[model samples]
Target: MKNNKIFLIGLLAMVFLTACNEDVLEYKPEGLLSQADVSTTENLEGLVIAAYAGIANDEMVGPITHQWVYGSVRADDAYKGGGGIGDVDVINRYEMYNLTIPDYGDWMTPKTWVNHYKAISRANFALELINEASEADFPKKTLRQAELRFLRAHSHFMLKLLFKKVPYIVETMTAEEKANATNDMTNDELWNMIADDFLFAYNNLPQSQDEVGRADRSAAAAYLAKLRLYQAYEQNDTHQVTSINPARLQEVIDYADDVTGALEPDFGNNFLDGFDNGSESIWAAQFSINDGTLVSRVSFVTGLNSPNSTELYGCCGFHLASQNMVNAFKTDTNGLPLLDTFNDVDIFDSVDGNGKAPLAPGITLDPRIDHTVGIPGRPFKYRNTVNEAGDMIYNFSWARDPGVYGYFGNMKEQQAPDCSCYVKEGPFVGTSKNVDFIRYADVLLWKAEALIQLNQVSQGIAIINRIRDRAANSTNRPINAGATDVYAIGTYPLTLSKEDALKALKFERRLEFAMEGARFFDLVRWGQAAQVLNGYVAVEKTKRDFLANAQFTAGRDEYYPIPQREIDVTGGLYTQNPGY
Candidate 1:
């Protein structure tokens, strides 16, 4: 993940090159496979598989399966916690939202740009092969090609989210065309191009695949729904939503209607290792441990996020939850969230509903907090049974630097140290549990957001309350042993106004997907990133000194600056994002 470790993630083509050092003996490297070795008509599937692997590869610093740095740290859901602000300081730069120019010499975002393109390149390479072959020659030609394009669009979509004006590349492009592909396309055009790939996949892919990891029709539909939802919030050059397109909102609802996925019966089922490809998982990046590979295909995105307990998770604790996020879960007398005044008090010291009384048994909060965050003196990952390290309660000592970041750790993506899926590589802990890119809950929420934007207020609130209902029933936890409350969470009434429904819908998303790396992007989509995040830092700076100088610039900070290295590699053809 560091600059020194960059070579380990060499492009897909690097494996095909003949490394013939003239002075040394070189005979095509005995164990390596050549392009011809894997490119035969019968083995064309190999190229497709390689494309999947390109996206599946996870490293903490790169844009891994879960984009914790881009989504969580950039938003109000989390703080970039580690040894200090200097530990993986590029993320610290991101958290602070300044000195993050294209040529700032930070490798994290640039490496993420490269990693996405690597995945895109693999898809293009496979597409080039498939384009020449007929369905008669390759029986699964259309199906495989659709899947490859789905992967290609996925990478481009993530790139668009991170850096808005990324060049859209395809297999049809000539060498010159590829070289000169610039970040000049209008937002609508680029979004349409990415959506075109998903549109094709949605039309061609089957409803199910023999391999659980493979993309299916429902996955394509879900992605199309997601794409349309983002596209609906039409933004200008300044990255502010100019208008919410009603047609696009309708498309989100229609595409969502085609998505045949369901929420897990219990909310906790979605995060458990045993439910990797459960009903709730519309599409996920499959991972594994003890699969006979050198180090196992375990998730490395949150590798640095395990608790710093030596006997337990071992190393760094990075993506810790924010006080604003924890407080967002607390409910008032009606058991509804305290939307406006939630962040008035820190999680460690919460006042009563009126903001006058100290915390007591009556400070009811959503039980999903028990599942999303790890608090000291509380059960970790719903486990009261002792772990292999002989600890169940989240120890206060597990936090790496609570003085820098609050004493809350991200919990949804993590596993217990004793679990078979758990693997500790040195100090970092990783799990083989699949990371959901599109959860059934996400599909429902996307429709809800679009509906609210389109003025279907009650329908949107109805959809959001489904998630809250699941949260209320997710109280099957190790009895919360902390001083904070975990009493009750209630659903919203249907009589709410459109504006209140929008607020409730957005709040529901923040609480439901709190630590799953989606908050910041949601804020950006809603054009509320600056107001919400700057307010978060204003209060957070008082508690954490590292955020004293933090600020979120409206025009520039909406999207990350285009990587300078990308522009250099393109012969300066790529234009940097605005304000960079």
Candidate 2:
């Protein structure tokens, strides 16, 4: 009995020793990477790529790159045209200017917050690794570091625009430091942190990058100019532009001067797929299809914004350009945009009853309107003729909810059904066309805005005329030649006063970048959200009664509330935005 007990004990000890072996414990799965594997030079590049990929990590419900929901739908450019108001009701809250709670649109607001920070975190991780690497061992270390910093600043800038306050997570932060990150800083301090990252990038990066989507020094300078322009409009806690700093406006002018990129000869080319990364695109977030993955990296940020046609690219119709938006393109007798008297006349009432039938006349529009809006019966994406299936025309039936939203379809983000950029997953139609993060035109306008604010009125007016000239010459398209009477745009006079020039600059921005999702942010940056949006609703509600009693409180509605989940997780270390 003693011998048998001894044998059992010896067998159990052998099994335990084998199970606890170092080789067995340290075995990594064939497909998985170990910690030390990421320390190499090539893997460092992979980390940078990962950071780039995160910039456009958007979905139908949560858009990180495209701001149609937060900027367009929230502003006068469009409505949340889905199945109904019940579908993504959080977006309705945004559109209506209702007082927001932290959990409101959590899917969208928090998701976007997380998405931006995710990209920032990836950049931070790559930066840590790149900083440790020697330039001798990894020749592109400094360059990669600059790229990572540019990306980090891009996300932080966006977060600042959205939430007004966010913790600056840096690579140097220890785990404990990260845990205690707080959102308690002056607006200038936060802007300076983001500006510091951009300054480093501008100093170190090349004028152009070898890769199409990479950020170059020119892109950094352009972004810096944009940042400075926002910073120049110093705001108080009540979200009022207390003072416009002249020095910062000069910075806007200087940084914009350092930038380099030419505008596309045809303004319509900016939205076309083949023209991506062309002269006008300073920096773009790239998308791909048929590249070696299970599912190609396509743009699902606009997935829900497709037409409702079963024969065409079918899905829920969203981000429809407002009647007010369509009317804002109307030109006066001088062929210049009607500055103040635009919303007084509704285009639908003036045209064919509901804008569905053939036009009756008496409306002259900016030629760029053809590029910005998808009017029913107009040439869909410049296709004058219908296909054999009879579907090229943008029909009124394309609207998912016509009674609630208007009849216009968003044109800029969409692709023609036959184009290679089109990709549909389930009911959602996504595209692979790159979203131009920074365009030359945007930089031009930034410089113009800065100059005007600095009281350099004539110089700014000249720039305004330059943009208007592009719009006037946009009538060169043969597709729009038959409708030449409807398309007319004129340049602003250089002798105009600063006040009139400022108005022209503001109106020009709306006409130039209508559906690109920057209107609401523009309003907020100018500290005109309450006045402009409240005024918009007063007139627009008469047209679309969904906004029956809409209001935009200046301080509260300027930025979204910081996500409650973030605050809770941090043990209330993160404070909510004012008036949340």
Candidate 3:
């Protein structure tokens, strides 16, 4: 009996020893673990914060790259020519219909692509880890998942617009899978993926975020609405009109209405100081001036490039607002668009001594003009006025030859004089207040656009009028004339038919959202991009020698060629765009 008991004890000891050995084999070093370890509820939150931080990088949301690529690289805006205008010149040439093989030397295309994908990859990694976590962390799981999904969706959306046939990688695939991957999906497939992600975000995200600039339900819906509108356009290959889903369009209208009450009473508040949290902003790039990390590339590009600056514009030179763009704001007899009289007016009015008047028209002339352009009298939004002499000296080259190259810095958000000088610290010293991503006004306009396309013209008109009135009286609605100029305060009365109202809506969008990065895509989705851009370029070339080289042809120039290098890397597995 004693021998049998001892044998049982010995067997139990052997079992315990084997189990301990298995546990030791399973142990992994902290650094050697998969992304699943680093992307926990605690660790992954920092990654979400890092996603926003990445935008301030020079290649991503940084001001110079963002503004130059999105703002000036369109038909309506021109590059102010000077000795250092190489980057602007390249953009204008492309905007004016020049196409080339992707050398990858162009920092704009490759850098933007890399930045967007990095953000996407980070978000993708977060999603992968969050999904693998336990249900006890579900709430954090849901929120982080939604945020990462929103980021991934938006990054892909931008790529879809630019590259058109980008590989739709949802997960971090192996090198073998990536090599085998191809962009065989249709535009509809791409749009569907974008819509699905946004819908998930809209359904799960909070109406507002604890911190500003984070994704919310309204922003997701707004983006979804935009994607729907783009899909509604007619397509070439399928010969099928991407009809608007009434149900989907109504979803957009309902979501847009959800935030109307949250909008600021004043439209200009959406763009001015202390306006970061105003109701008008559905979502904007979060930047804290006090945090001392808010860097803006747009502020650098548009601010006064002066004596101490080595930027493209030493003074204020780049993104010269064209006379045509300004003229688009003129009101008709009934305080409506000068659609019929569009070509009748002289846009190049002479400037007075203070760089104000006739050339520098008052907001009273057209509130939009005042909002977008810096006339002689009003303060420029982003220029360094304190060091005027220095600014003049640095930007003298462009000022001397405005006609040859468009040289006029945008003044929407200027840096302080002391920080105006370019240094190892940065191109500008002040905090970057300019938006690098979405804005509330953009969301509102996007809703207005979708509504108009859905035959909800009157509703769309109300939205636009709200924006105009904001600029008129520093309020969102019309008021009794007092200190404000009533004539300058144009009434956006909806007297036209549904068809005509659509045109008016389009024009209003062009005027209000001008140079804010949506123009080219807006034109493309509306099916008028080819005609409008080409026609404008031709007419401008005839009118100005500087524009003589600027010409656009439809079809071939409508979409850019897939970077040749990407295609080569895929060994012809990836097909190029039709013309490219």
Candidate 4:
């Protein structure tokens, strides 16, 4: 069955050809229309769907290999799995850190690159076909084009974030165009193209998308803000400390503020299954488990589960939250990261197998700990069940040997248990939950970060406090006030000097966005990757037995070696990042 799935994916690639030689399709059907037949507006929508499909593709945003692996795994939030060749390679070795190239054959690297461009191509094709269709109405055409532009810009932005110098291909370039293509643009030129694409999307897209999954003007604006922020980081890059462009940072402040009004009052609701279209979600990848369609099964791959759940092949447990990540939640007496003492906390105590006092002095921890980590003795959001023996069982654990399992996994956004049955044999599992691409709280935090950087510390605190207020005061049934423990632990008497305020914002972002794939990039942008990662290496060597056996460095290991294969292909046309 696994071979069959791979074959299907291969066949699908042939059906929807891209300018690039590689194919992005993960599955193919037994029968399908020819490429020429699929060139019309109605037919092209399927292709457009295929493009969106890439975001949810296992290699990209989908469950098995979300960008989170690169974003969080390389940072402190997660450790690589413990077994197998690839498993040890990713987790233990520092050399393969940002493994996003075709040569490494990480599956995710090529899939991510191909998927984004595939989606962009579909959007481009959609715009072209719709423009020629006589029956298309002006409003529909305009909206569809706006949606396409947003998607194109979104994909390009993602590529730029990962590979700082990807070729900027706006229109669908032909094979001849590809032959002449070169990584000729300077960093500024590439960023300008990104900015232009996003601005076009912001100007043309609707404030809100009619569909639950499509991008809106606000999403485009948010991307623009992020792009500008990144570009500001690249202004006269000296690597040691690049100054943030004030003009560009101010633009980020304005654009982020424009979307701040769309925030939902309840922060948790923004992640609920039915709330994919909630006020806070500017954009999300849509999935559904109905009709046995494997298209909607991303959650099954990303959700926390044991190694041997029968519903899915024994491919669970990739992104295990680390002890350092868990420690980040503990606050100091002054309500700030116990910066001086965070490393002093004993994280292993939260689990029974490890020794030391429980994170706090109890069998359980503050409620937010319960909400975030799936330590023993804690109930997950949706996995509470009673067995025939009448003992409550939290099904978050792996079904190891079927009847003998009784452990918990992260249950914050669990889909039905049956959702995993869709894969039954392969590394994939089908889940119907919508994956949020952008949420209002994130935008709020981004704005807050920008404001702080711009010297508006008080305003930044107000924005962050708004998010905290919702988590603390939500009247929704069984609100866990302990989630606010961090606020009290870290924010009272918030006395911070300008530099301290910036550092606080960084810590706040780390805590708030843990396990969400934002930490690594955050470290990079702050110019603190070398410091934090080196600290992690030293501490891991002294404290963690498993990591003690590894070797790593700070300056050389900070940026990933541009996949060796990419260098070979570019043949000196592209320069590798320094120290790679």
Best candidate, lDDT-wise? 1
How does model 2 score by TM-score? 0.92
Cα distance off (Å), candidate 1, residue 445? 0.8
The alpha-carbon lDDT assigned to residue 26 of candidate 1 equals: 13
> What TM-score would each prediction reach against the true structure?
0.92, 0.92, 0.79, 0.80
CA-only RMSD, every prediction: 5.6, 10.6, 12.0, 6.3
Where in model 1 is the C-alpha error above 4 Å?
A: 1-37, 350-359, 482-484
Off by over 4 Å in 3: 1-40, 55-68, 78-88, 137-139, 172-175, 238-248, 289-316, 351-364, 382-400, 406-409, 413-430, 434-436, 475-487
In order, what lDDT does every prediction score?
0.81, 0.80, 0.55, 0.54
What's the number of clashes in each of the models?
0, 0, 26, 11
Lowest summed lDDT across 10 adjacent residues in model 4 is found at: 1-10
Question: Per-residue lDDT tens digits of candidate 3, residues 1-580?
Answer: 1111110112211221221111111211123334655655656565565544444334322232244455445656544333344534555456556665564334456556565565566566556667777768655778777877887788778777776677766655655675677878887787888888888898899887766567788778777766776776745642223455566566666666555325556544555545554566664554443322233222333333222234432343445566566667666555666865564565534444544334323323455554465443333443424454243221323343455543343433433243432222343233334353555566677677678768778888888777667656653322112243334556566655677767777777777666666677676666666677777766566645666666655555555566676667578877777655
Count steric clashes of candidate 1: 0
| lDDT digits (tens) for residues 338-437 of candidate 4 | 6556767565343344311223433222224444544443333423444332312233344232111122233344433433223332553445556676
Error of 3 at 251 (Å): 3.7
Model 3, residue 55: distance off in Å is: 4.6
